[model samples]
Target: MSAVPEPAAVKTAVITGADSGIGRAAAVRLAEAGMDVGITWHTDEAGAERTAREVRERGRLAAVARMDLTRLPEAADTVDALADELGDRVDVLVNNAGTGSAVPFLDLGLDDVRRVLDVNLVGPFLCAQRAARRMIARGEGGRIVNVTSVHEHQPRVGAAPYCAAKGGLGLLTQAMALELAEHGITVNAVAPGEIATPMTGQEDTDVRTVSRPGVPLGRPGDAREAAAVIAFLAGPDASYVTGASWSVDGGMMLMGPMAGSHLTGDDWRRP
Candidate 1:
């Protein structure tokens, strides 16, 4: 009998804001699963290189680029550039770059709100469009995972812009999923709650040491925990799953009603 040839391996994945935290974790996870990764950072080239080193240590190819999500259509060029460096195809795109504003709605400046939306919403939109176009052109299925927050489904008191941008992204994920299904593309969002990442000022701290009473999990989530869920969505098992916002929040979304009832005064509204 003749020997059978194995299929060729897929090309690469482009992950934005992958210098640290959940983005870095996801990059490492996917690389461990035998995928080459392209990492992008805003101001942390050193951190990005560190992540690339980790990916390389896993025996996968790694590429790095600078991507400022606020730069819009121009920033999205990084995706193409990365694809060019990684065999001219991107099999997965993770839009994990985002910024948040802690100011109250009334206290927020227009520029601040715009900046948040530019990073969290507009940036993902542009990148997804660009990646999807490439995926469709290549006639191969692709995956897109947007790293939203718990606020994507619920509102936060002091994070007006962040909440709004995440909420919009939740819908955008569904929209992309619907429109891209015919092209074998899957679009989804991962909503993480209270992850122990630098964004929460918890970098290098053990998540088990943090107490989050409101979260049913009793402690903040680990960045790797969130990354695992993202990895599942990007892998072959998620071929049938699309247009879903997977909550990697440790059941925190279930505490909304109980938390609201416990709020006894206006102090909670003051930021």
Candidate 2:
């Protein structure tokens, strides 16, 4: 019998803010799918290490790096550093690191607004640019997934900065997809609503435990649920998917009109 040729090595995925929440879930899921993972954390070194451990447990190489999105260029450099650690190539980049603000628009500070934009919008732009450059240079197609929010499409009472940043990111995803398509790189966004994660102050809680009347599903979404969408966008199945925003929000967007009709007072508009 003729000898069979060995398959090529698995690709690598770099996920920002992988210390926890959707980022961590995506990292683990990608690792499970046989891709080496590079995880980045801002202030949660321990959490990043835990995620890396989970990735390694799945029998994939895992690398960890500290990335502060405020330092956009430096933060982008971490992707290159991680690629260096993971065989000099990056096949997927997940811009999941972000910050949120809840102050009323009138009370929001200028500095705080800038911080949110820097982290949520500019940071991801730089990171994606860096990854795209590498992918284009490598002459291989790649994936880029941005984690936006339901607020990207709808307004939130006290989340002016967050909403603005996410909305901008949503459009940026489409623009990048248009520009990067020629290079065979797909750019997409995942908009998650009421996900059970530390960012929502729901750590260690089952999504089923939360009650969200606005969501048709009647509960929050699990981090893994959002991660599954990201994993799909980053995998070969999404080869034809680009310039799109996937709502992993359990039909939350559908309740907008209903929520507006049920609003009986002006209190929601108050600071």
Put down candidate 2 lDDT per residue, 35-131, tens digits, no spaces: 9999999999999999999999999999999999888577789999999999999999999999998798999999999999999999999999989
lDDT tens readout by residue for model 1, 82-192: 988998999999999988977877888998999999999999999999898988778777899999998999987888899999999999999999888878888999999
Candidate 2 is scored at a TM of: 0.91
What's the residue-level lDDT of 23 in candidate 1?
97
lDDT of 2 at 149: 92
Worst 10 residues of 2 by lDDT: 1-10
- TM-score for model 1? 0.91
Q: All candidates' lDDT scores?
A: 0.87, 0.88
RMSD of every candidate to native, in Å, equals: 5.7, 6.1
Clashing pairs in 1: none
